[model samples]
Target: MVLQGALGVSLTFNCGDTDVAQEAVERSFAIASERGDPLDRLRLLGPMQMLYFRTGRFGTALHYARELAAVAEELGDADAATLARTFKGVSFHLRGDLRSAREELEGALSGRPPKEVASYLGFEHFLAAIFLARTFWLMGDTDLALEQTADVVSSSEESGHPLSHVITLMWAVTVFLWQGDIEAAENHIDRLETRAAAHGLQAYLAVADGFRGEVAVRRGDAAGGAQRIRAALKELHAARYELLTTPLNVTLAEALCAIGHHAEALEEVRAAINLVETNGDLVYMPDLLRTRGRIEAAMGPRKRDTAEATIHEAVTLSRRQ
Candidate 1:
C-alpha cells in the first residue's frame, strides 16, 4: 500500500498535478522509506530524483541521485546504476559543470552497445544524450554537438517507443533553433506537435506551441511571436512544467526587444536569471545573461556600461563551462 501510494505521488507530480502532488511528496516518501523493502525504497528514490530535477532543484536532485546510485549498487542492479549516472550527468549539466557533466554522460553511454541503450537509458531514452549535445554546443564544439544531436534523433526514432520519439524531438529542436536554422526547428516542431497530439501529451503540445513562437521570432514576427510564446508559457507554468521556460524566455526577451519593449524584456530576463540562480540551476544562465546584455545594448548609450558588464560576465561564464 505504501509503495503504491508513493508511486501514485510520483505520477501525480510528474503529470503536473502539483497542487496535491507537492503536499504528498514528502509524506509519501517518508512512509515508503520506513516500511518498504529496499527495492521499494529504490522505486521512490528514482521518481524523487526526477521530481527535484524537473523542479530545478539541481543540488537536491543530485543528492537523491547519489542515494539512488548507492542503493542500486547495493542491489547489484547495473541498469539502475546507469540511470543514476545519467541523472547525475544531467544534474551536473544543469548546474553549469560541463566537464563533469560530459564525463558522467559519456561514461553512461560509453560501455554499452547501441542495442542495450534503449533499455539501459530507460524506454524513453531520455535526456542524457540530449543534454550532452547542448553541453557540447555550449563548449563551442558545434560540429560534435550537431553530430551528437543527429545521432540522438536517429536513435530516438528507432527506439520503438512513441513517447521517446516525441521527447527527443521536443528537446532536439533547440539545437536547430540555436543554430538559427528555423526551417529545421520548424520541421521538428511540427513532428513534435503531431506526436504529442497523437499521444495526448498535452504538456508537450503546449511546449510545441512555444517552439513555434520561437520560430516566428527568428523569422521576424516579433510581436506575434512574443504574444504566442507568452500564452504558452502561462499554460506550461500553470501545469507546473518548467523545463523549457528558460529558453522560451530568452526567445521572448529577444522578441520583446525587437518590438521596442526593451524595459519589459530586461525585466523578463532579469527575473529569469534570478530564478536560475536561486534554484542553483545554471543550465540557462549564460544564454539568459547574453540575452540580457543584448537587450541593454539595444537600449542605446544610456545602458552601455551595464550592457558591457553583462556581456563580459556571460562570456566568462560560458567559457568557464
Candidate 2:
C-alpha cells in the first residue's frame, strides 16, 4: 500500500489520470492509518496532504499537515517535522490566515538552514519559503516578500534538487508576475519550461505553458495568449489541479480585458473569486477583486462608481491583512 501511495504521486505528476491517482493516494492513506507502521503513515500523509492542498481542499490539507507534524514529533524526525510545518503554513496562507502562515513558515525555516531540510513527499523548505514570500506580499511586506522569493531560488539552485528547482521557478512566477516584472517572469517561464520538460515534470510544464501565455498577453498577443492559457488551463483542470487555477484565470482575465472583452474578463475574475471562496483558498481574493475592478472600469463610465468601490474593497482587504 505504501508503494501504491508512491505510485499515486507518480500518476498525479507524470500521468494525467487524476481521478485514479487521487483514489490510489486516498486508499493508501486510509490503509496506512488503519494498519501500516508509523513510518508508513508518515510516508502516506505527505502525499495525501499534497493531493488535498492542490485540489483546493485547504481544510483537509491542514488536517493532514497537523497529523503529519504530530507523527513526525512522535518519531523524533526533525526533518519530517520541518516539512510538516511548512505544509501547515502553506495551507494557512491559502486559507487567508497570513499571520499564522508567516509564523509557521518562519518557524519552519528558523531552527535550521533550509539546506538541512529534507524533501518529504512533495514539500521542502523551498515550498515553505514560496508561500512565506507570498504571505509577506499579501500582508504588505513587499521588500520581505521579494527577499524571501530570491532566497527560495538561490537555495533551490544550491541544493541541486530538480523538484526544488521546478517548485521554486514554477511558483516564483507569481511574485514576479504580480510585481509586473515581465522580463523576469518570462525568463523564469522559459527556464521552467526547459527544466520541466527535461525532468518529465509534465504538470510544471503545463504550468509553464500557461505562464508563457500570460507573457504573450503582455507582449501584445492577447488572442494567442488567451487561447494558449485556456488550453493549458483545461489540461490542468482535468488533472484536478486548483492551486494555480486562480492565477491562470487572472491572466486569462487580463487577456480578455486587453482584447476589449470587458464582460468576459469581469466574469472570469468573479469566477476566480468564487472558487477561492468556495475552496477556502482566499489567498488570491484581493488580486481577483482588483482584476474585476479593472475590468469594470474598462466597461465604460457608467461602471466607474462600481469600479472604484470594487478597487477600494480590494485595497481594504489587502490592508486588513
**Model 1 agreement with the true structure over 73-125: per-residue lDDT tens digits:** 98888766777778888888888899998988887777777566435324324
| Model 1 / residue 183 / CA error / Å | 1.3
Query: Candidate 1: where are CA atoms >4 Å away?
Result: 1-16, 22-28, 114-121
Off by over 4 Å in 2: 73-77, 115-118
- TM-score of every candidate relative to the true structure: 0.91, 0.92
List per-candidate RMSD values in Å. 2.5, 2.0
lDDT per model vs. reference: 0.80, 0.84
Q: Report the lDDT tens digits of candidate 2 across residue range 1-321.
A: 867787788887774587878899988878877895788888888888878876778888889889988998988988878877888898888877788899989888888765556666544677888888888877778899889888888888777788888889888998888778999898888888888898787878878889888889888999999999999999787767777898889989989999998888888888888888888777778888888989999999999999999999999887765
The best candidate by TM-score is 2
Query: Which residue pairs in candidate 1 collide?
Result: none
Model 2 clash pairs are none
With candidate 2 superimposed using the best TM-score fit, by how many Å does residue 211's alpha carbon deviate from the native?
0.8
Q: How much is 315 displaced in model 2, in angstroms?
A: 1.6
For every model shown, the clashing-pair count is: 0, 0
